[model samples]
Target: MSNPLRLVLFDVDGTLVDSQGSIVSAMTASFSALSLDAPSRDAILSIVGLSLPQAMQNLAPQQSVANQTRLVDEYKQAYHAQRLAQGAASSPLYPGARDVLEELHAQPETLLGVATGKSQRGLDALVEAHGLERFFITRQVADHHPSKPHPSMIQAALSETGVAEQHAVMIGDTRFDMDMAAAAGIASIGVSWGYHDVSALNSATAVIEDFAQLSPALAQLWDK
Candidate 1:
């Protein structure tokens, strides 16, 4: 019989790409445009995996819903403008990221997908730009479904891919990812190379320091 663990879900922003700096810059620019306080880098980094509106809410809790909406709009505008101006050059993959995905793709029993807070357009642009499209069979973008900490997106991935929760694993860089995976009743593997610190992802089933360690770490999963 085949191994039950057949599906591997990934989180995009921090896990697959180092987009923290670009994200922070865009957020800061948005705040500046609105004459609001730009959150510290640490504060923005802490909320990496949340949906845009949710992130805005977290960053500016005292603001009214209308204000939050305005912030999110401004943030997206600035982010898009920067991407266009710079040819979307921000956020390259971490070391060995491509190799890890290639290796994972080589496994016949394994299927890959993504669950990210980025909008579909943004995610598509990034995936295409990096030539990472071949690895992901399905992508669950933020606006396409419910945000992280909610099981809807993960559920969509599982349903679309025909992967069972017990036989799949979610890999990400935040507690939001872990929490979502746990809520979906699946195993989670966290990466330390992302926005969240190692301690933040400590609750994950496994924490990998880099993509080079991913294969062996995943192998150990089924060995247990």
Candidate 2:
């Protein structure tokens, strides 16, 4: 008999790729293009796992909706320009990320997917640059979902992969990811080296400090 298939979904930014430099730079440029003062680095990172519209709303609540729309446009343009300039160097994977992903991908009974706040264009660029297009079977992006904490992305991934909630896990670096998993009735694993503070990950089923701990963490989670 064959082992049952299990799906593991990952968040792109912060979790897999450390795109903080590009994120911060693009955000600053977006605000600057509109002659607006950008939010502080901490404030910007706080919304890292949200869709751009929701992120803009959070960062500039007092701004008119029109300005928020403009901010999103500017951000997309600036981020794309930066990506074109730097390619894969713009967002390097965290230490051991590729090795861990490779190990997971090699498992016959395991399937990998992505549930990210990034748009399809952005996600595509990152995946191509990193040569990770073959690793993930499903790619859920903010372009087609309601963003993290909404369960839309997770639900879609589960539906697409035909993986039961109990047999799937969401791995990310923010409460939004934890909350999304909880909403989707799946387990969540949080990483400490991401944008959110460790305390913010209290809702996660498991928390690990480095990529090396991921496999064990998954084992422990599934053992429950």
Best by lDDT: 2
- Per candidate, the number of residue pairs that clash is 0, 0
lDDT of 2 by residue, 1-224 (tens): 87678999999999999999999999999999999999999999999999999999999999999999999999999999999999999999999999999999999999999999999999999999999999999999999989789999999999999999999999999999999999999999999999999999999998999999999998887777
What is the alpha-carbon lDDT of model 1 when measured against the actual structure? 0.88
Q: What does each candidate score in C-alpha RMSD?
A: 1.2, 0.7
Clashing pairs in 1: none
Superposition TM-score, candidate 2 onto the true structure: 0.99
The runs of at least 3 residues in candidate 2 whose Cα sits more than 4 Å from the true structure, single-residue gaps closed, are: none
How well does candidate 1 match the true structure in TM-score terms? 0.96
TM-score for each predicted model, relative to the true structure: 0.96, 0.99
lDDT (Cα atoms) of all candidates against the true structure:
0.88, 0.95
Instruction: Looking at model 2, report the run of 10 residues with the lowest lDDT sum.
Output: 215-224
